[model samples]
Target: MTSAVLHSLGAARPYAGSRPLVLERIPVPAPRAGELLVKIERASLCHSDLSVVDGSRVRPLPMALGHEASGTVAAVGPGVPDVKDGDRVVMVFVPGCGDCRACDAGRPALCHRGAAANGSGDLLHGEAVLRTVDGERINHHLGVSAFSDYAVVARESAVVVDNDVPFDIAAMFGCAALTGIGAVLNSAKVSGGESVIVFGLGAVGLMAVMGAAQVAGTTVIAIDPLPEKQALAARCGARAAGAPADAEALVAEHAGDGVDVAIEAVGSARVMESCLGLLTRGGALVSVGLPHPDQVLSVQALQFAGMGKRLLGSYMGDANPARDIPAYLQMWRDGRLPVELLHTDTRPLAEINEGLDALADGRVVRRLFTLAP
Candidate 1:
């Protein structure tokens, strides 16, 4: 038996939006049917987690808040045959039933069953395995709360991988790398020699740059407020634009009309609108960031219609995790995706609050929370 101390969201609203998560020794329950008990190796702090902590995105109280991670299967539940104890895996936030309308159409990323489960903060089976020592139920976040020493996740929610793949890289692939790169290749279907621009140089934004590198002859332009991030984006195969004004200038300089594809990784309505403006006539704008629930975005209706432009929303980069996870890992192995460039720091799970603080200030590209045996 392993001792598991799970971090639970304790406050309805964090005191002044700081120190929101409370750590406790929650019961590490065994996986139920069609589930797996994973000993989390590393959990990457996500922007969505930040939103939840800051009270911007509200979920059930006392939920164990983490979704993106890499882990080793400690146990497998009945009916799960493909994986067993000691298997390494990277988790996926959404799980498809394989029978949903979206899944039937080969778009498992937007499966209604998974979306409904995430919305209600429940497992696909409508039960949470985690519990407090006092027998209180602890809500699981997106079916995989990796902030704990262990998490019980549906068998379909994670992909087993070779042990040689670094755990940190696998942890980020679950979210940042997958979503960012997926936006370019999967959502936008950016082709060879296409011009692309990404707004915001966060981890996901940088991943878009890395993803664009895969398409031969693709040109990547990056826009961000932070000079350091712009510099980083340049290193990741993008032409740096220090601000939106500079981005427009770069767009004209690189692509005579405008970029063939523009991506908005910044979760602001203003940024989304600006991305639409960055696209050339008949070009596509892919919005990957999760904006505020109440935020309403608008574009030039007549202009967009006349230009034959498309505004697309990419959830999880329109990724089919079962197919894309292996493809991304193989791409990394083949030396095409330079995901390691975004890695900044790794701290113990105890330092998650500090990690979130850095994320809040935009100080770190990506931080992985390591779990000790």
Candidate 2:
């Protein structure tokens, strides 16, 4: 398999910085029990991947860096049922261990021991599947590591999709699309006629716009610093798009009171605070952005008490990939959700860094890398 591996860590920077993403050839990974070997066709570049590449998040070095992707099943491990070779699939970032406590409670996103399972860089019993030319160990990020031309992911992580859905669109669903749309529908549960304000008009934010728009009579307000992003936000069904300087005014204008739901998709402390302030009484604030470890979100107790505002953190859009991925694809098919607009560009795996750079510079909304022709 050919993969872009991060071999070292340097200053924490965005993709536009000088850190190089190395492309190398290695042996294709084989599936273990309860795993699936997938031949990746399209892998989407996500802001999270950019964070990992920039060293904002702590990931093992010499790691294959990607989590959003769609591919075809090349092989299936023992005990995996129904799915077979040549089946179209999208990879899930969170591969829940079915018997874990969180899974039993129907919250696999918070599964105990699951993080250890995915983050340990080894399979079930401390076995590494990917190695470098010098026989050095290569860690797997998230569970999928779909940045490679091929990947071995747990069967639980591979969501089978309809044949009609294009691979590029399917790949975006693995992360950005799912995270944004799911955050609105699953996490915040924005209802019909509710007013929603989504901060940061990236792929995730745009998906949130589409999700809110799907709700009958819902008013969508999009906030972004860039005019291009604001324009794209309007196209994604936002009732109005405005700068951060105009967020409060925009919310008041649309909602008449304040927004019923405020979603913060950018990983900035200031934006989070702004989202919180934009919410009406008893409104919910859902945060989808993963801020740096050292950064803290400061909220005043008195303000929350007076405003009756609730703040919640969402991961992977509070998504249950097994259920949500298929539903989202169906919504896309029905034209209720516009998945095509979320994708801005596609490149080869060798240009992964450049893709990330485009994302960092806001040159692209959602960029996917075609791992194979």
Which has the greatest lDDT?
1
Pairing residues by index, what is the TM-score of model 2?
0.95
Q: Could you estimate the TM-score for every candidate?
A: 0.95, 0.95
lDDT of 2 by residue, 1-373 (tens): 7898887765344543655577889988778887889999998888888887766787877788888899999999888888999999998887777778877887676656557756676543235678887787898878878888888887777899988889988988888877899889988998998999999888899999998999999999999999988988888899999999998788778898788998899888878887777778899999898888888878777667897899888888878888888888888889888879878878877777677778878889878888775
Clashes of 1: 0
RMSD of each: 2.4, 1.7
Q: Which ten residues in a row have the lowest lDDT in candidate 1?
A: 1-10
Best by TM-score: 2
Expressed as tens digits, the lDDT of each residue in 1-373 for candidate 1 is 2222333343333232546676677667988898999999989888988877766677776678889999999999999989989999999998887899999998888989888877777777667777888888777788788888898898878999899999989998988877999999999999999999999889999999889878999888988888888888887888545677798888888887888998899888988888888788899989888887889988789757799899899998889898898999999999888788888989887777777778878889988888784
Candidate 1 TM-score, C-alpha based: 0.95
At residue 285, candidate 1 shows an lDDT of 89
Residue pairs with clashing backbones, model 1 = none
